[model samples]
Target: MENTGSFYNRLTLQALAIVEGESDLIANLSNISALLNMELENINWVGFYLLKNDELVLGPFQGKPACVRIPVGKGVCGTAVKDNRVMRIDDVHAFPGHIACDAVSQSEIVIPLNIGEKCIGVLDIDSPDLSRFDQNDEQGLVSFVTELQKVL
Candidate 1:
């Protein structure tokens, strides 16, 4: 297996390549979600939720359908946006105000997508296995989001 750092390095490069010339936001986010679905193992859902009108609206995703809207500061995704930080829950069930879009999702990670000081959206990933994400995954995804911010 590839080391986490190397794996994310490649993933970030691939993401950059994929969105290189694409100027459309939805198209880029859709493709990114697809790319994550194909590369990340043990993940059941990968997607983005864009901030709109003080709430998060589902942007693009891979997996079963998810909640369409989340109020800022409400659920995991919302809290990430409200706090402007990444939320990595090893066990979603224990997380207060965790909105269960999928009951099968045992673990989750939400990375707030920011441009300067304003948060635009979030990259949300879900897994069925407990403790599916660790510090490495968090750092890697944070790096991924950092690069993604440049393109968007």
Candidate 2:
């Protein structure tokens, strides 16, 4: 298998190319999911929860069964969407009202994906290691999301 960052670097470039070509959103999301699973090391889950209508519905993901419906202000994922900011949790258990989709997950980083200045979805990543994400990830994810929004 490819090294984690190497995988993300490859896929991120691919996604950028697709965005430049104005390709499909669903296909883009699917590729993102695959990239997260393949690029991020020791991750239990990585995917998106897209806001549709008024609720957050599950989008393309690379993991086991996840919570299908998340309200506007529920778990870490929900709270991120509701707050419209990145929520980086070193320990999910410590976060109040954290919805435990997988008990094995220790840390999580959720970035709100915005389009046209509207919060449309969330990019969520989970890892089994404590403090799996940091400022670097936050910056990298922000850049990635910025790139993603160009065509969405």
Candidate 3:
């Protein structure tokens, strides 16, 4: 995926435009999940984990069944929210308290979904290959979240 940053950005921006002016959260998330699933390569899963009652609950996703709930400060998705930062785990197995929602998922990226300083959820993507995510992916995904926040 050399030089894919610009392409991804353009694609995500166009995808977001399609959902612009639509105020339904679930509908927007569902479309965004589908867009990621279709656009990203070598990815096993793409989805959202919404924060509810201080816990992460599985939201719109395009993948096999996943864990429904993860406590705040627990697992990759939770940690991203707790830290209010993006997490790109090169090897999920090496990470402490890693949640193995998919046995084939070797690497993962979790981007916190926030409204101002308050985290409301995460955009979680997993891959079957190790070291699948890097700083570039983090930056691109962060931009994706920024666009998403506008519609949220």
Candidate 4:
């Protein structure tokens, strides 16, 4: 198996290749979600929640059906968008105000998608294993998001 850094580096490169010259938002997000689902291991859910009218509306996803709408500052996805930062929860059950979209989702990481000073959405990944993500994952995913921002 490849190391985490190498895995993410390849993942980010693939993402860039997929989105290159693709100006359609939905198309880019859809392809990205599929890429993450195919590449990431042990993750039950991987998708995007786009901010709309101060709320998060479910976008393209690669998992079972999820919550359609979430208010800002409410759940992991919401808090990330509200604070304009990444939210990585080792255990979803312990998180106050966590909206359980999937009971099997034990750990989650939410990365807010920002365009300059405004947050447009979030990239949310949920894992069934506890503490499935670490600092390395965070750094890599942040880099992935940074590359994604350039095209968005």
lDDT for every model?
0.95, 0.85, 0.91, 0.96
Candidate 4 lDDT tens digits, 45-118:
99999999989999999999999999999999999998999999999999999999999999999999988878
Question: Higher lDDT: candidate 2 or 3?
Answer: 3
Considering only N, C-alpha and C atoms within 3 Å, which residue pairs clash in candidate 4? none
Cα-based RMSD of candidate 2? 2.8
Off by over 4 Å in 1: none
Task: Write model 2 residue lDDT over 36-64, tens digit each, in one string.
Answer: 68766789999999999778899999998
3 or 4, greater by lDDT: 4
Residue-pair clashes, model 4: 0
Assess candidate 3 and give its lDDT. Answer: 0.91
How many clashing residue pairs, candidate 3?
0
Q: Name model 3 segments beyond 4 Å from true.
A: none
TM-score of candidate 2 relative to the true fold: 0.88
Report the lDDT of model 3 for residue 46: 97
lDDT of 3 by residue, 1-152 (tens): 55868866787777788688888989989998998899888999999999999899999999999999999999999999888888899999999999899999999999999877778899999999999998888888898888778678
